[model samples]
Target: MATPDPSITTWEGIGHGGGLYEQGYIGMAHGWSTGIVSLMSNYVLGVVPTTPGLETWILRWAKGRVGTPQGAIEVHWTLGEDAMSVHLTVPAGTKVNVQVPVKKGQFVLLNGEQIEALIEEGYVNIGDVKSGVYTADVRQRGSVACKPG
Candidate 1:
């Protein structure tokens, strides 16, 4: 729950069935491309890096000063079922925080709050479940999605 501060700068989006989303790249490079497109689309277990070379894995950190670049994503599963989706175009005074993790039995749906609010907001809808595994954390302006479920 707490252990996501390795000097930051972490990105790993591997999708194409084997969903995996990890984000952490705060300030700079447009905040790591707005936190890797809101943690590869709303969070792991719903992997979506928009394909195409997948931005070559993505692990960034080239000195600070970035001020607006932040990213975090993580995804882990063991069984069947998988779903990941992502889409963000923020920039006009942006602010987004989408975090989903409700495991004990399993069941999570995002539509209005549970921590779903975007300012200058563009688009954010999440999905994950069908077997057991969940972890979706999205922070905007300085992006982030600490994947794994």
Candidate 2:
């Protein structure tokens, strides 16, 4: 079977008593679904450069995956009874500050291993991270949520 071409197919409201409807045409797409794609890719994930470009930046790690020219960044996480597990990806050629709210004693689990970090004002700043994927288990009290990690 063959499907009719959309341009020739009569859409709904074609007979709703209108001038354009009599011609069987409609408006073009506005791309509203992804209107925030750039915003999510660049700003929400922390590619909005402190500098003019992405030589250096701050990343507020939320759970999602996005790609940039600098590199592809990804984050995944799960909540445990007493801790939170996070998976993260850093872009290449750029130094980023990743801070999250989790603490196990004085260190956090980087790739299922312990690593030293800076904890201030209920935020744990992970150590200098290389460009790669890592599974991190951090410590925190109550609901461990953060925009930095």
Candidate 3:
């Protein structure tokens, strides 16, 4: 059942239904979950994987949209049982680029470590690669740093 007000998009979930509407009803507040995950991964945690199977990756945090008075965000994650935990953080007005699973002799650092690149498939590629969250800030105007060997 819905209210008479057309502007009121909120509604109660009905236990009986099928397909998309049924799924939506089953998880009436699913958007909140997705939104929180998106905020943490894209804006707060800032973890973006590049290449298939996360062969490469990048991290960039946004302090403005975090809705907190603080000017930085901390991120922590684990890789495997043998690998050590990885932790990173970024403050307001700071820029950083990280690439994972990099191969030797494939990338070149230019402009006093402000730029990172490599020739992939005969193409000169830059930073902010793709896989999970897309970071336009790095691609637009930000320094690039390759993964340490």
Candidate 4:
């Protein structure tokens, strides 16, 4: 009779129950669990950005083909006096059918009236008043644009 190594026995017990084998599998599982945990934690903590001078907005757009699992699309944009940044996340089954126009000082008028006209016209007029960065984020399912007041 020989004694089995504790580490090997433990590994075998865990692995016998359809456990991960390679280190890469464990790492990937950890990463996914971490992401889910973080998202849940944020929701539980009510960690939303709220400030007078800073604005945080979330828009959920559903349209064409995207690359995510929920068939939903997320687009992020930030506009300030000197810079603008944009990021887009699209799920796997949706398609984004809008063309985002980007130009300096081009404001996205989200009013129903303005949006209707712009959608019909396919474009909007932009004038040069002050020099600032403009950003446009477009994906297969949605788009988002923002500017600081």
Clashing residue pairs found in predicted model 2: 60-147, 99-148, 99-149, 100-148, 102-139, 103-139, 103-140, 104-139
lDDT by residue (1-149, candidate 3, tens digit) is: 13356763434343344223555545543444345554566655567767666578775432333323435444444343222222345455554464432233333332223244554554334443322222211211332443333
RMSD of each: 19.6, 13.5, 15.4, 14.7
lDDT scores in order: 0.34, 0.60, 0.40, 0.37
TM-score of 2: 0.47
Q: Judge candidate 2 against the unseen true structure and give its global Cα lDDT, from 0 to 1.
A: 0.60
- Order of candidate numbers by lDDT, starting with the best: 2, 3, 4, 1
TM-score of model 3 (CA atoms):
0.21
**Candidate 4 to native Cα RMSD, angstroms:** 14.7
Better of 3 and 4 by lDDT: 3
Error of 1 at 36 (Å): 44
**Where does candidate 4 stray beyond 4 Å?**
1-70, 104-149
Q: Write the per-residue lDDT of candidate 1 for residues 29-88, one digit (tens) a residue.
A: 234434655664435434434557566343211111113443323233222223332222
Candidate 3 clashing pairs, residues 3+ apart or interchain: none
List, residue by residue over 90-133, the lDDT tens digit for candidate 4: 45544444344544334344311123224224343333212222
Identify the runs in model 3 with alpha carbons over 4 angstroms from their true place: 1-25, 28-32, 51-55, 60-149
lDDT at position 40, candidate 1: 49
